[model samples]
Structures are given as C-alpha cells and as structure tokens.
Target: MDDAIIRRHLSVGRLTILEVLHDEPGIDEDQLLAEWIRRRPPASQAHARRLPRTIAQLLWQLRNLEWVDDTEGELTITALGEYVREFARLHSPSPFASRTSTVGGHSA
Candidate 1:
C-alpha cells in the first residue's frame, strides 16, 4: 500500500479513537478496546486481538502528527486533529462512487 494510504488509515484510526474518547472521556484501555470492537464488528478476530497494539501505534502516530495531546492518563484531541477530522468528513468519498475509479487513482 502507498504511504499516503497508510497515513490515511492511521489518521482515520486516530480520529475514530478520539471520537470514542470524546463520547466517554477517561476510558481505560480495556474499555477502549471493547468499544472499538463494538463499533467495528466486521473486524476480524485476529484484528480484534491485535487492537491494543494497533491503537497504541495509531496513538503514537497521532502524537507525532500533533493531532492529540495526552497527560496523566487523560487524552484529548488537538485543534489540528479536529480540523483534520472535519476536513476528512468534508472530502469523504461518495457511496455511489464505488463503480468508478477516481478515488485513489485506480483507472477502471
């Protein structure tokens, strides 16, 4: 996969985690994992098993990107993260566009 695609997945993962935390601030890691599994039921069992590591990786990436701030067991989305999430939503692919290949530059 392209680095950009990986980056986008990291961003999306971070955004999803942040949104979950926003809904229930001060959640512990286990709670976070449970919530993620509940939200993304289609995720494979292996994926679910690896969620903690994945989330940690995403969190680290988000921290490096300045998209989140954490201290003393509390985490919060930074202004940059909020802006990115909003921008992503605004530019999200249309559901009906799947028949085309404009997205991600795949010609059909």
Candidate 2:
C-alpha cells in the first residue's frame, strides 16, 4: 500500500477503480461499470460503454490482489485498497500527466 508498492503495480485504470471503491463503498458491478465509465476520459467512455461484460474481469483482478471485496453483489475497498488509493492521490503524479514538460533542465 505504500508508494513503492503502488508505483510498481500502478495503472491509471486500476488506480481509478480503487479510488471509486473508496468513495462509493458497497457499489454493485453494474453501478461500478457505469461509474467507472463516467469517470473515464471522454474518448474511452465510448469504448468502455460497450464492454459491460468485462466488468467481472476487472473486478476479478482487484479481488485476486486482495484490494477489493465483492459480497452479495456489493463492492468495497479493503484497508490495503484504501491505502493504495490515498497513496496514489497524495504521493503519485498523474500517470497521464504531460511528462513532456521540462524538469531540472531535462524533459520529463
């Protein structure tokens, strides 16, 4: 759940899912899909909107990692999940951020 653990496994989509679960505990798969797509960038929303069936796979990975719990059609973050989410927000730079900008006289 620390920055190093997160940075090693980080992906924008995974991070978003964790954050969503943090804010919307007990959400269902259907609802999580809708919310997830809603939170996605406009361009990806169109593609994600067509892949409702893939939600299970996404949730499966998170569950397998012990980052989330799905019980009785409801989802919630585990303590480690919340820690990952908060660490991402407070310690990680946006994965999608424009790294083309210069830093320390070198392009990031």
Candidate 3:
C-alpha cells in the first residue's frame, strides 16, 4: 500500500467517523464500528477482527489530539478535525504510482 494512502486513511478515518455521527446524532460505538466495517473492502476473518481495534486506537488518538469531543458514549468532530480533513482531501496522493522500499528481504 502507498504510505500516503495509509496516512490519509488514518487521518480520514476519524473525520469520516465524526461526519457520520454529525449526520446522525446519538450514534453509539457499535454503530460506529458497524459503519466503519461496512465502508471497508472485504477482508479475511483475521483482518476483520483487527480492524475494530485499529479504529478504536485511532479514535483514542484523535480524542487525545483534541480533534474530537467524546461525551458519554457519543463523539463529535472538532473544527480542527474538519479543517484538516478538508485539507487532506485536497492534497491526497496521486492514483498513479508510489514509492516502495525493500528491506530485510521484504518489499514495502
């Protein structure tokens, strides 16, 4: 995967979550998880299990960054997050090709 794409996804995940919640207030964790899962492409069982934990961590980080407001069990995106998302989408990676690195007999 492209590093830029990965970074964008990591950043956008939080924004998307917030956007969804904003459109539908009072959404719970389960609903958030479900929507995230639905948005992702089909994956293996192992990947499916791991995705939730990854998303949880991302949400935690966003909360720590003060880009999201978590009250009770609900979440809302801060102004900073919305602005960042807009900027990121404007500067998203190209769809042509990306750089790769080879290390320790592995290609990344």
Candidate 4:
C-alpha cells in the first residue's frame, strides 16, 4: 500500500473513478459517470437522486488531490492516480478492491 494512496482516504467511488480514468484516459465526465454508475449503481431511488452530486464531489476531491485532471471536458488519471490504482490492485483481496478491505491488516 502506498502512503500517498493511503493518505488520500479513497472511497470505492473515488477508486472506481481512478480505475476508469486509468483505463480510458480521455473519457468525458458523462462517460466516466455512466461507467461508474453501471459498475456501482446507487443503493436506492433516493441514492440515485443523490448519485450525481456525490460523484461530482468525489471527482472534485480527486482533482484537488491532483489524482485526476479534466481538460476540455475530458478526464485523465495522473501518475499519482496510477500509483494508487496499482496499490489497490495489488492489495485488494478481491477484484475491484473495496475501500473496506481488511486484508493484510489494512483497512481504508
């Protein structure tokens, strides 16, 4: 686990955003959101209502952390983000690592 990634306190949503950007570096926000929603849909109708705002906030936070960059309405992961993704992939107990994974006594 990387200290930089660990310090980010990344949630599943944020992690998903990073992974998607890592896979598709120049996708726009709509595409990214669509993929994220497809992969991790909201819990309920109410959650779906709040999903856009929440995802926006998460993306905003990642931007502030310099993990992602959005230029001309397209998003791309930074090197730091790739580092985080690699750490998550390696440390994750299962596929598409969860933020709450308890493997190796690491939970974040």
lDDT of each: 0.60, 0.68, 0.59, 0.74
What TM-score quantifies how close candidate 2 is to the native fold? Answer: 0.73
Candidate RMSDs in order: 6.3, 5.6, 7.5, 3.1
Error of 3 at 45 (Å): 0.7
lDDT winner, 1 or 2? 2
Give the least accurate 10-residue stretch of model 1, judged by summed lDDT.
99-108
Candidate 4: tens digits of C-alpha lDDT, residues 4-24: 546446556667888889878
In candidate 4, what residue range of length 10 has the lowest lDDT sum?
99-108
The stretch of ten residues in a row with the least summed lDDT in candidate 2 is: 99-108
Question: Per-residue lDDT tens digits of candidate 2, residues 1-108?
Answer: 455545666556566678788889999988888787677644565665665655677678788778889899889999988876776677645644532322122221
Which pairs of residues have clashing backbones in candidate 3?
A: none
lDDT of 3 by residue, 65-104 (tens): 6666778988777776565555445555532122221111
Identify the runs in model 4 with alpha carbons over 4 angstroms from their true place: 1-8, 95-108
Candidates 3 and 4, the one with greater TM-score: 4
Better of 2 and 3 by TM-score: 2
Candidate that scores best on TM-score: 4
Clashing pairs in 4: none
lDDT accuracy of residue 26 in candidate 3? 60
Show where candidate 1 strays beyond 4 Å. Answer: 1-11, 93-108
Distance from true position, residue 7, model 2, in Å?
2.2
